[model samples]
Target: MPPQRATLLQVAQRAGVSRSTASFVLTGRHKDMRISEDARQRVLRAAQELDYRPNLMARSLRTKVTKTVALVSDTIASEAYAGRVIQGSLAAAVAHGHLLFIGETEGDPVVEEKLISDFLDRQVDGFLYASMFTRNIRLPKLLHGQKVVLLNCLTRGAHPAVVPDELTAGLDAARTLLDAGHRAGIYLVGHTRDQVFASRERLAGIKEGLGDAGVRLAGTIDCNWWPDSAYDAVCRALDDGLTPQALICLNDRVALGAYQALREAGLRIPDDVSVISFDDSDLAAWLRPQLTSIALPHYELGWRAIETLLGQPGEPAVQRLPMPVRRRASIGRPPAE
Candidate 1:
C-alpha cells in the first residue's frame, strides 16, 4: 500500500507544539504570532520532513488574493524584442513574490478582453498591457478597479507608462555623426506618419540635434520599417545624385537595407557614406560595417512597468529610459573628394 500523506495534525504532533502554533509557523505568520524561534524551527523541520506542499487554491481562497499578475501582450513570443521584455518582467515579478500569467493577444483587442475577463474571474492581482511598439492603442475597459501597467505602450490620459527616451537616442546618434566630422548632407532614413511613436520621437530628436548644428533636413524616405524599404530609399537617393555624408536610419532593418543600397550603388560606407540607426538590434553587429546605433532600454522598460504598478500610485508617471549610442564600424569621416 502507498504511504499515507502527512496532515497538519501529524506535523504538529512531530513538532511537539500546539496545532495553532504549527499553523502559524507553517503559514509564515510565526513572527506576528510571537511563536518561539525554537518551536518555529521544529515546525519547519517537521514540514520539510513531511514534504508538505500547501494547496495554493485553498490559500488564495482564504486570503481573497491570488497574488498572480497578468501580462497581456500583442504577439509577445513572436518578436525577439518582446522576448526580452517578458524575461525582465518575469524576473521582477518573481522577485516581488508574484506569479505572472502571460497572455498573447495577437494585436486583437477582443482577444485581450477575453483574457482579461478570465483573469478578473480568477481574481488576478494586477494587469500589464504590453505592446511591442509604442502604439496609442486603447486598453480594455474591463481593467477598471484593477491595477493596470503599460509596458512599451502609450497611455494617453493619465496612465503610467515606461518607454525608451528616443529623444536622447536621436541626440546620441547626431552626436556620433557630428563627432565623426560629417556635417554636409545628413539624411534621415525611414519613418513616416504611420511609424511607431518611438520612431517619431527619435526622428524629432535627430532633427533637433541637426538644427542645433545649423544643419537643414536633407531628405527622408519611408522605409516601411523594413530592410527592403531601406534599400529602395537608398536606391532612390542614388538615382537622384544625392550623396549624403551621413545617413541616420530609423532602426536596424532600415540600416540593413541602407547598406545593401549603398553597396549596389558602389559607395563604400564611412568612406563614401556613414550609417547609423536606432534599436541597436542584433543585425547591427552582423552588418559588414557594423552598424552604429542607439541602444533602447527595452528590458528596463519591462521591469519599471511592474515596479510602478506595485509601488505607491501617484500622478501618472511617464518614465523615459535613457537610450545611449552604441558606437561601431558603420560611421567614419567622409571621403575627401
Candidate 2:
C-alpha cells in the first residue's frame, strides 16, 4: 500500500488555520487576503512539515490558464543541427513555470492540423511555429487570432519571429579573412544563387564586407550545399590553375569537401590558403586543421521565440539573433607571393 499525499486541508489542520488561509499563503496572496504574518508563517511551516504540494491542474481550473504551450514545427525536432531550437524553447518554458509540447509536421499539413486541433482541445496558452531552416512560411488559418511566435522563419504577414542574423554572419566571415590580409584571391564556395534566405543574406554580407575593404570576389563556385559538388568544384578550380588565397565556404560540409580537394593539391591550410565558412557544425572542430566558421544561433532563436510568445518586453517584432564566429585553426594571413 502507498501513503496518501498531503493536502491543503491537512496543512490547515496542522497549522490550526482555515483551508482558505493556507491557500492564500501558499499562493503568495496572504497579504491580499488580510492574512497575518504569524498565521502565514504557521501555514508555510505546516506545509513544509506535511510536504504538501499544490495541485497545478486544480489551480488551472480556478485561474482559467493552462500554463502550457505547443511548439509546432516543420522538421525542427528531427534535424540534428536544428534540435538546439527545442532545447532553448524547453529551457525557457521551464524557467517561466510553463510546460512545452513539441509536435513535428515534417511538412505534412494534415499532421499539422491534427496537432493544432489537439493542442487547442487541451487549451494550451499559445503556439510556437518553427522551421528547420530560415525561410518565409504561411501559417495555418487556424493559427490566426492565437498567440504565436515564429522560430527560425518568417511570414508574409506581420507576426513575431526569431531568426539568425545571416547578414552579419556573412559580413563577419569576409571581414575575418580581409582583416587577416587576404585581399585579391578570395573565393566564395557553394551557394551559387540567392535561392535560399541564408545563402542570399550571407552572400550580401560578404559582398558588403569586401566592398568596404576595396576588394572584389575572385570567383564563386555554386556547389548547392553538397560535399561532392563542392569537392568537384574545388578540384576543377585548382586544375584550371585558379588558386585562391582564401576560400569562404557556405557551410561546414562544403568546407569539408574543400579540405579534401586542397589536401589532394598539396596545399596546406593557412600555409598556402586560409578557409572560413558558416554553420559551425560539429564537423568544424573535428577537422584536422579546425575550420573557422559562423554559428547558426539556433538555440537563441528558440529561446527568444518562447520569450516573445510569453509577452516578454523588449523583444523585437522580428528578432535576429547574432551569428557569432567560432575561430579555430583553419584561418591565418594569406601566404606570400
Candidate 3:
C-alpha cells in the first residue's frame, strides 16, 4: 500500500493551532488575517515537517474555476522567437499562481480550433493566441465569452493585443545607418505593393527618419521574404545599374542571402555594400560580418498578452510597442569614391 498523505488537520495538530488558523497560514491568507509572525512561522514549520500538500484539483473545483489558461501559437518550435513568447507568458502566469496549457497549431486554423475546443471542455480560465508572423487574424466565435489575448497580431474588433511597433523599428534602423555617415544609396529590400502591417509601418518610419535630413529613398526592391528571392531581386537591380551603397533587408534571412549574392558579384559587406535588416535572429549575429537588425520586443508582448487575458478582453484596438535597432558589423559608411 502507498504511504498516507499528510493532511491540514495533522499540520494544525503539530503546530498547536486550530484547523482554521492552519488553513489561513497554509493557504497564504495569514497575511490578510494579521496573524502574528511567530504563529505564522509555527504553521509553516508544521506544514514543511509533515509535507502537507493541498489537492489543487479540489481547490479549483471548489472555486468553480480552473487555474489553467491556454496559450495557442502558430508554431512554437520554429525558433527562439516563439519560444521566448511562451517563456514570457509562462513567467507571468506562474507569478500569478496560474498554470499554463500550451498549444501549437503550426499555422493551421483547424488545429487551433481543436485546441481551443478541447481547452474549453477542460474549463480553462482564459486564452492567448500568438501568431508566428504579424498579420490580421480572425478568432474563433467560441471565444466570445472567454477572456482572450492576441500576441503579435490583432483582430478586427476591439481585443487585447500586443505587437511589435514596426514604425519604431524603422526609425531605429535609419538612425543607426545615419550615425554611420550613410547619407545616400540606402536601398530598402521588402515585399511588393501588398505591404503587410509590419512592412508598411517600418517603411514609413524609415522614410520619416530619412526625410528629417532631407534624404530620399535611394531605391526599393520587392522580394519574397526569403534569401534566394531577395538575392535574385538585388542581382537584377545591380545588373540594371542600380548602385546601392546600403541594403536594408526586410529580415535577417533575406539579408544573409543578399550578402552571398553580393559576394558573388564582387561586393563585400561594409566594404562595398553594407547590410541591415529587421528581426535580430540568431542568424543575424552569426553571419561573417554580423548583421545589424531591429530588435522586436517579443518578451514584453508575450507578458502583456497574458496580463491582458487575466483582465478582461475589450474592444479591439491596436497597441503599438517600441522596438530598438541592434547595430552590428554589417553596416558602415559607403565605400570611399
Candidate 4:
C-alpha cells in the first residue's frame, strides 16, 4: 500500500494549535492574524515533521491567479538557432515564480487558434507570441484584452515587442570594416527589399555608418539571401576584375559562398581581402578563418518579452536590443597597394 500524505489537521494537532492558526502560520499570515511567534514556530516545526505540502490548485482557486503564461511561436521551438529564446523565457518565468507553457504553430493559423483557445481555457495569466525571424505578425483574436508580448516579431497594433536593432547592427558591421582601414574598395554582398525589415534597416545602417566615415560603398551584389547566388555573384565580380578590399556579407551563409569564391581567386582572408557579416551562426566560427559577425540576441529578446508581459520596469512598448559583434579571424587591416 502507498503511504498516505500528511494533512494540515494532523500538523495543527501535532503543533498543539487550532487548524486556523496553523494555516495562518504556514501561509505567512501570522502577523496579520495576530498569532504569536512561538505558535508560528511550533506550527512550522510540526509541518516539517509531518512533511506537509499545500494544495496549489486550491490556493490558486482562492487567489484567482494561476501564475502561468503561455509561449506561442512559429518554428522557434524546433529551430536550433532560436532555441535560446525559449531558454530565456523559461528562466524569466521561473524567476518570477510562474510556469511557462510552450506551443509551436508552424505558421498555421488553425493550430495557433486552437493553442490559444486551450491556453485561455487553462486560465493562463498571459501570452507570449514569438517568431523565429523578424517580421510583421497578425495576433490572434483570443489574445485581445489579454496580457501579450511579441518576441522577435512585431504587429501593427500597440502590442509590446522585443526585437534586435538591425539598423544599429548594420551600422556596427560597417564601422567594424572601416575601423580596419578599408576605405574605397568596400562592397556589400546583398540587397534589401521593402518586406524584409532587417535587410532594409541593416542596409540603411551600413550606408549611414559609411557616410559617417566620409566614404561610399564601392559596389553591391544582389544575392537574394542564397549562398549559391552569393557565390555566383562573387565569381562574376572576380571575373570582371572587381577585386574589393573588403566584403560585408548579408549573413553567415552568404559569407560562406564569398569564402569559396575568394579561395578560387587565390585571395587569403584578412590578408589580400577582409570579410565581415551578420547573424553570427555556428557557421561563422566553423569557417577556416573564423568569420567576424553580429549576433541576433535571440535569448535577450525572449527574456524581455516575458518581462514586458509581467509588467516589469524599464520595458518599452517597442524594445530594440543591441546586437554585439563577435570578433574573429576574418577581419584585419586592408593590404597596401
Q: Is candidate 3 or candidate 4 better by TM-score?
A: 4
Once superposed on the true structure, which residue ranges of model 1 sit more than 4 Å away at CA? 1-6, 312-316
Better of 2 and 3 by TM-score: 2
Candidate 4: stretches off by over 4 Å: 1-4, 311-314
Colliding residue pairs in candidate 3: 157-316, 158-315, 158-316, 159-315, 159-316
**Per-residue lDDT of candidate 3, residues 251-281 (tens digit):** 8878977888788788888898889899888
lDDT for each candidate structure:
0.82, 0.90, 0.83, 0.90
Tens-digit per-residue lDDT, 1-337, candidate 2: 8788899999999999999889889989998989998999999999999889889888888887989999999888989988888899999999888999999999999999999999998889999998887998999998999988888889988888899999999899889998799888999999756658999999999999999999889889768687888999999999999988999999999999999999999999988989998998998999989999899987888888888888556666898899999999998877884
Residue 70 lDDT in candidate 2 = 98
Tens-digit per-residue lDDT, 79-116, candidate 1: 88557788878888887878999999897878888988
- TM-scores for candidates 1 onward, in order: 0.93, 0.95, 0.90, 0.94
Cα shift from native, residue 224, model 3 (Å):
1.2
Q: For model 4, how does the per-residue alpha-carbon lDDT over 108-155 read when each residue is reduced to its tens digit?
A: 999999999999998888999988889998888989999889898999
Which of the numbered candidates is closest to the native, going by highest TM-score? 2
Least well predicted 10-residue stretch by lDDT in candidate 2: 308-317
Q: Which ten residues in a row have the lowest lDDT in candidate 1?
A: 191-200
Candidate 3 TM-score over all chains jointly: 0.90
Clashing pairs in 2: none
Backbone clash tally (model 2):
0
